[model samples]
Target: MTDLSLIRNFSIIAHIDHGKSTLADRLIQITGGLSERELKEQVLDNMDIERERGITIKAQTVRLDYTAKDGKTYELNLMDTPGHVDFAYEVSRSLAACEGALLVVDAAQGVEAQTLANVYQSIEHDHEIVPVINKIDLPAADPDKVKLEIEEVIGLDASEAVLTSAKSGIGIEDVLEAIVTKIPPPSGSRDKPLKAMLVDSWYDPYLGVVILVRVLDGALKKGDQIRFMQGGTQHLVDRVGCMRPKIEQLSEIGPGEIGFITAQIKEVEQARVGDTITTVKNGATEALPGYREPQPVVFCGLFPVDAADFEKLRESIGKLRLNDASFSYEMETSAALGFGFRCGFLGLLHLEIIQERLTREYDLDLITTAPSVVYRIQLGHTKTEDAQEILLHNPADYPDPSRIESIEEPWIKATIYTPDEYLGSILKLCQDRRGIQTDLTYVGGRAQVSYELPLNEVVFDFYDRLKSISRGYASFDYEQIGLREGDLVKMSILVNGDPVDALSMIVHRSVAEDRGRHMCERLKELIPRHLFKIPIQAAIGGKVIARETISALRKDVTAKCYGGDITRKKKLLEKQKKGKAKMREYGNVSIPQEAFIAALRMGEE
Candidate 1:
């Protein structure tokens, strides 16, 4: 029998596109957790989008049984976490399942904003850090520089750095050996009361809600009745299982084991991702470890194009909510967009994914308004509530000055890491976006700057501008800081001539003039002229500053179709006329694609 004390539970953490997934594939191969016949890079991130995007969106866990040359079989539970800041909450939950973290840094690129943030998170969790300098086979690989930077910036030992090319499988075996040698084993008594905290979860069609958890104390088994600390729900455990990355059914789960438990649960709301699952009758005297409250940083209006599809969209969102507990939904409507729901999310990416899934998976066409960060306002003699409570999604519902005391909006603790050459450009870009630089430090040849920015400033194109300014060499990451007082106004766009009420945003009044003017110009490029000229305007409270005129269709229908069929030409012109009517006609203009695309791109800028 292998010595169980040698078993190590750990996770790989890094910035997006920094080879975290690639390194994970190599580790799987070396430990024989995956066979040669089943080899595929980044297989742990099985979702189609994950592979296409080359990023891991969710955390996956696997166990590897490796026998060292000393003839010892050690079981290693390896958790692969998402590298993007969008999934920071999920990342934290994944970290709770492991006792150590392998902090992988790009040898050439050095540390990124996400890397620094994740490293800080790991330290907060009190996990032992094992630094791995990855992508060493690249032409720009600089292990010595990265090693020294890690020691100086993060206070880790330079000698402990493991230089590896996970792509070429170099230094992978040593990494495993280092895990056994450096990372400590889980410590807890199996005899304690059964207390385990659930991290990430999924609803399998066959197994119902498969809850992934780390046993903080004692043991749990099949046939046990579990009580969920969340909402005080309870269920009978039908099965307990562990993942070899290929599910292995087990009779029980022991202390420090990351595994799943299945009950007869039909709905996922009962077994939330961060909920505590415990023995009903013989569970812990206190609640399970690592429970966190869900908070939403961004909110958007989602409405189906067809009223008949409303219920379908609602059902689709319900299904998505099963997998993502952080996403919340509330019934909301707007005169411009009609029936819709106000969906809450952790960040911009979360809102986009839900919209994409609603269209792709649910097969429902949607009309989503621009995302808005929830604002806080003091009303009615010092009563504080989210500005969203004022129902500002509709212009008619916006509160008057007398009804509001002070308006507060979300803020972000943002960090941007880039090459030293791009510092000036990046600073100018950040300044334009209203970002306040709180600190700046040098890591190797790269520079890291911390900014306290209003989330509204970045909710649009901060990421895009960061990449554009740095020539795609810079990376940025942010986490929600609290809410702050802000001077913002709801600006509306008059598509063609008529104002479509749904397409408005809460923007800083200072930039409204420039943004409106730029938006109208961009819209002129997207919207095609039909029968009449189209005038696109950006206005705040009925005041228009910038305007664009889309000239009328000069030659929409030729005086003759040449030698072509006249019926086809007539039908096309008739269709064009019908499109003009369907458009929200304001005065004499007809708006088209350019207007919609411009509105969409505004969020990016």
Candidate 2:
């Protein structure tokens, strides 16, 4: 029997690019969890996109038996998480599975936007935090200064903050020692009914649905009938296993342990994340209360570049969804782009990664429409009865003008951290985006500013602009602040008098004209010149805001003539002009598919 007293379950939390993944790699090395040949960079991060982007996409759990200087062997479970703010929900789910967290920070950079957000979350979870200042090998490493900053900003005792360089293997042993001493073992009783927290789950072709779980109470064994309390579904446990960086079949696992369970489930929906698991016959009466269905904030259309590939794209998404439950899609059609799926995502990076995976893993080319935030549009009582209100997720679904009484857009409170020098530029950029400054403070020569801005504004180049203004020295984190009334209108782009739904966008009424003008001008450059003039116009509710024209293709009238008199040349020129006029009278302009895509990114710098 394993002693519950000698176990520590904790996760690593840090800002993006703060070396959380590398630190995880170092810990694996010091513990000798895997052989030298078995070791590689970010062993826990399993995705190729994650490796190439140098970010952790999924929260991976690995178990290691670490022998401490106290002459006792301890089981340490490390749940390394994604650093981007988009995965905040995932972060919370991973934290709930642990009793403590290793708060990692960049030695030179000190505290960042996401670092503070995650630290606060850890505090809320009541997880014991062991601060570790990483990247001490860098020339700019300032452990002492960062220690004070951690104390000042986070209110945590930084005097004992571990200083380590993941690259040089410095202070790796100390980090392990701190984890054993500082983080308390989880408190639970194996005598109780089986209760496990299913933090993540995915589909395996052979095994079907495999769930990553954290045991909170009792014991889970193979062949036990289990019930997903929240899902109200039961299954027979097919396999019991743990990831020691590899899936090792285990006979049984007790409290404070992290492992996997193949429950003979065929679909991902059966094993919803954050749901509680218990024995089917004598399960706990109350399910865990933390389960929440992930709500996607950013939405866009994903259409097959080739219309015939729609079914393939749908199947590919279905397979991927079995892995990522947060990613969602529904069948949708566009007047401009044929049948497609309207997909929802956690954020821009999540959206991009899924798109990339679909293209690479499934070998399917896709046409992705411009992303949009959900809007709440209220309509007064109809002619017959009750008031009508609509929640619009796609711009193409905007209702008629007369039905819209008011529009409300989602807003978020964004915290931006940067040096004092770029305050002016940051201020201007926020104001232009219609952001309302809520608070500003200075900490250790760095400026921390908070703004309440529309979610749509942030989705559209806000983060990129913040980095550009601060010269790449800024970090930002935001949380939704609910919806508020806004003067918003749906602006549409017309090519050759035909509306292109993919090019439509919801913009503030004040900047509708400016945005329309920009869109028209951008379309003029992107749309090819046809035999007849093509008119590009932007309008709101039938009111034209801006217009541009792609001039007709012109040919040299005398280029093909070898030798001709002046009269012959004049006659040829007149005949050519008459033919062009005739063509213009009856011909229709054909706008290629790529033009619509180009218009979506034309506003981006």
Give RMSD (Å) of candidate 1 vs. truth. 6.2
Q: Best by lDDT, which number?
A: 2
lDDT of each: 0.79, 0.89
Model 2 ranges with Cα > 4 A deviation: 555-586
Q: Write the per-residue lDDT of candidate 1 for residues 394-484, one digit (tens) a residue.
A: 3334566566766778788888888999999988888888888899988777888898998887877777777877889988888888878
Residues 455-506 of candidate 2: C-alpha lDDT, one tens digit per residue: 9888888878888889999899988889999989999988877788888999
For this target, which candidate reaches the highest TM-score against the unseen true structure? 2
